[model samples]
Target: MKAAWLITIAPFAACEPVPTAERFIPDYRGVETMLLADDLVQFNVSMTNALSARDVENYAECAAAGYTLIRGWGFARHLRTNVDEEAGVWTADAVYTISPALPRGISTIDAEVVSAACAEKGIPTV
Candidate 1:
């Protein structure tokens, strides 16, 4: 009986460990930026190994923040973000309004602050 128990436990010990953050590290594919209007912009981002929709949305937000800075803007307000995943690849279609002054919304983002956070998080920007 002891031998049987040891044999079962041995196989369990050999099993692979649980997934870690390194295992799920995302592969940022690319970002496409489009100017919808004077201050409105659209960001399309794609990636793989995304753990959740929030990852793709963050990518889009990062792109938007970078674009805002590039356009000499200091802020961006999130309009919308749509996330999709297929065949293990995640994509996000996001829209934002860039402005020199803070936009009148709760989703406003400071371009410099968000860009720095994105860099620290290893997320790519436009």
Candidate 2:
């Protein structure tokens, strides 16, 4: 009985422990804002070590929110967002419309609220 116990303990001791995965941290690059029309706006953002396209998209959204606030608007509606990755740099092209009232769409965002949330998350906004 002692030998059996010793054999079992020896096998367990020889086994190696599993390695833990490292945490992922993204590096934000920069943002460029462009006014396509009177109420139409565009945001171009780039970043490295992005986990996914959603990260860049959120960056663009934050920029739009900040811009809307700067333009004295209360709300914005998301029109579209195109994401691309090249040589480890992620880029996003996003478009939005600004208005004083809630836009007629489900993708509308409250500029003040989104801007505050972006600031709290340490994300840069235009």
TM-score of each: 0.83, 0.80
Q: lDDT values of the candidates?
A: 0.95, 0.91
Write model 1 residue lDDT over 3-122, tens digit each, in one string.
999998998887979877866889999999999999999999999988899999999999999999999999999999999999999999999999999989899999999999999999
TM-score for candidate 2, please give it. 0.80
Best prediction by TM-score: 1
lDDT at position 38, candidate 2: 90
Q: What stretches of model 2 exceed 4 Å from their correct place?
A: 1-23
* Structure candidate 1, residue pairs in collision: none
Model 2 CA lDDT for position 72: 96
Q: What does the lDDT come to for candidate 2?
A: 0.91
